[model samples]
Target: EAGVTQSPTHLIKTRGQQVTLRCSPISGHTSVYWYQQALGLGLQFLLWYDEGEERNRGNFPPRFSGRQFPNYSSELNVNALELEDSALYLCASVPTGYSNQPQHFGDGTRLSIL
Candidate 1:
């Protein structure tokens, strides 16, 4: 049973630069979701992909988007990043056809915009 993993546990970037974060879902999972958690803030859903297609997305701007690979891994892409974008980007994966199943999250990729 492979658990989720994120790259570059911490990320630092200047304002206006783009960043891409990676995530690998646990084995046997089929849904991957991306979230943004600012300092002292709650989780904000960015995108959701299940069965290799976009399933749902939050009210984020177009710049916030992502996709799930055939292997169930996923990536989040934020373009024209802003200082406000500085936050811990977390990814969660759920089981197939189990929307209510508790989502398993990775440690998250911390993105810092100067």
Candidate 2:
């Protein structure tokens, strides 16, 4: 089966700029998970968008938000980007009611802030 896919493999932006990262989950998946991996840091859960609603979110600031579409694709939006926001933004997906199952992840979109 095809794995999750993320768009714009790489992106560059300046501080205060806003960016949107897109993700398409594997076929049959209904939930999307977003994580941010900063330099020298482990993956940090950013948010979870499922079905068509914003389900749960991490301790990130309000500048971070996301949404799920009817097709199960998801988008992560970052406002007022900062240098520290530069990192690999990963997207994962899992089938509904299969929370116990491991989530499939994409290569991730690399965001760089200058």
Question: In terms of TM-score, how similar is model 2 to the real structure?
Answer: 0.96
lDDT of 2 by residue, 15-94 (tens): 99999999999999999999999988999999987788888899999999988999999999999999999999999999
Q: Give the best candidate by TM-score.
A: 2
lDDT of 1 by residue, 17-53 (tens): 8888999999989999899998787998888899999
Model 2: number of clashes?
0
Among these predicted structures, which one has the highest lDDT?
2
| Model 1 worst lDDT run, 10 consecutive residues | 92-101
Whole-model lDDT values for every prediction: 0.90, 0.94
TM-score of each: 0.95, 0.96
